[model samples]
Target: MISELVMVPTDEAVLTGDLVVPGHVPAVVLFAHGSGSSRLSVRNRAAAAELHKAGLGTLLLDLLSEREEREDAATARHRFDIPLLSRRLVAALEWLAQEPNTRDLPAGLFGASTGAAAALMAAAERPERVYAVVSRGGRPDLAGDAIERVAAPVLLIVGGSDEAVLGLNREAAERLSAPHEIHVVPGATHLFPEPGALEEVAEVAGRWFLAHLKERRGPGGRRA
Candidate 1:
């Protein structure tokens, strides 16, 4: 396994992340954290651990620089800047392609909250590289027109009780032309704090990645 702290250089700033890839894993899932969250998010860490059990790699990144995070915390700025976030994510994906350990493996994305929208945008921008996408309590509606361009299969995981976001997810699902599904965690809230709720999210997400990431795309951008 390769586990380390890495720096991803973007046009504007350098982002820090924790990368862990087990030996012989099929794919690496890059995590896009929600507003105000970081690479150290407990929920995301738990989910990454679960993915590891499925022989998948994971990279948990802070989409913001330290200065930007502090500023966002105080003024609530930068977190909702979907374009900036998506650009940073796209940069990370490019960096991963150049990284020695992950260069040959297919990649997937796991986004949470607003980060989901950014992930979708990045996927739209780099369709040939991203094999699949998974969103956890995500705001895919925020992706706007980019949702229609994503070529990879997608999985939307929402808490059953997060009604407003669930409705938004349903609307976004309708806009997506790519293969997709929505999995609702019964009685769980937006953060899935309920007992066993997050575990369920991790399990289902792991399974989805296992199924989709292993398949190669054939002609006309369809899964083979």
Candidate 2:
């Protein structure tokens, strides 16, 4: 496996990211962290590790620069700026497409919290590039009309005990025109901090990405 630090250039700033690829990987998963979180998030890291073990490459990125993170921490503005985040994500995806190590691999998005909205919007914008999407404890509703435009298969994972967010996910799922499903982790809350709860999420997410990515790849490791 190879792990490298990558700087993704966006229109406004250069975002830092960690790119890890296992030997002979056929697909890659890009993570979109939630509000107030970064590439160092333990939960997202755990999920990425599992996906790697499942033979998928993973890219975890910081959506904001150091100065932007500090400013957003104070004003809480950039975290909820879905369009800005989506554009940044799109830029990262474009960068991946040009990179030799990951360009040939199918790409998927795993988003958490508001990042989920950005992931959905980006997937909608680049329908042919994104093979699948998974949202963990995310607000897909925040993507607005972009939800209806998404062409990739989507999996929405929510905590069983997080009634408020579960409701929001349900409403958002209704607007999706793509193949989608909602999975609830019993006894888990919005963060899925309960024992074994996050592992369940990782398992479901890994399976979903692998299955869909492989399907998209088809025979002879070529895009179908």
Candidate 3:
């Protein structure tokens, strides 16, 4: 419940996020927030807090520049840009890999909406570095070519009624060579911010990361 927020200097802008370290951090999660959202996004911040309670360290990152956000950012209603966001997500990972308190943590990604695509793209680009991936109402189809290359196990969490995106996620799942699963939150919509919905997403994601980020495994869940 009591977590700390900090900003680390990236090669470019100073990257900001909260880090919640448990008694012994079993793994780390880097949060990629969706369109027009910042590291302060409440759903992500809450999820990070829960993950820390579940024994994972969290780094919730902001994925864009003020200038780019103002000029090219999506409108309040529709602001999802996959490609531009992906690059920034990757850069944030590179920054985390060097930051002292986080450097050696076995890293995973928790991405929402378009942020999911960026997380997948980063996982693909830095296969050896990223250990697991989870997408909440993700548009990972937007990741296109990068989805097939991801080395970590991926969990795609979508709202059952978010039909079009669900189809896109299924299509992307077929292309992934990594160990993967797609779980739909029944009766939920794109946001999955409904009561108990975010909680379900966090629980599933924590379990997935625990399975994949470990040094040894024996089918509490599958692995790639």
lDDT of 3 by residue, 59-128 (tens): 8876755655575554553356676566666776776678766676668999988889989998998887
The ten-residue window of minimal lDDT in model 2 covers: 213-222
Cα error of candidate 3 at position 99, Å: 2.1
lDDT of 2 by residue, 141-194 (tens): 999999999999999999999999999999999999999999999999999999
lDDT of 1 by residue, 73-145 (tens): 9998899999999999999999998999998777899999999999999999999889999999999999989
| Estimated TM-score for each candidate | 0.96, 0.99, 0.87
Residue ranges of candidate 3 with Cα displaced over 4 Å: 1-4, 8-12, 72-81, 215-224
Indicate the worst ten consecutive residues by lDDT in candidate 3: 215-224
Looking at model 3, residue 32 earns an lDDT score of: 90
lDDT value for model 2: 0.96
TM-score result, candidate 1: 0.96
Evaluation by TM-score, superior candidate among 1 and 2: 2
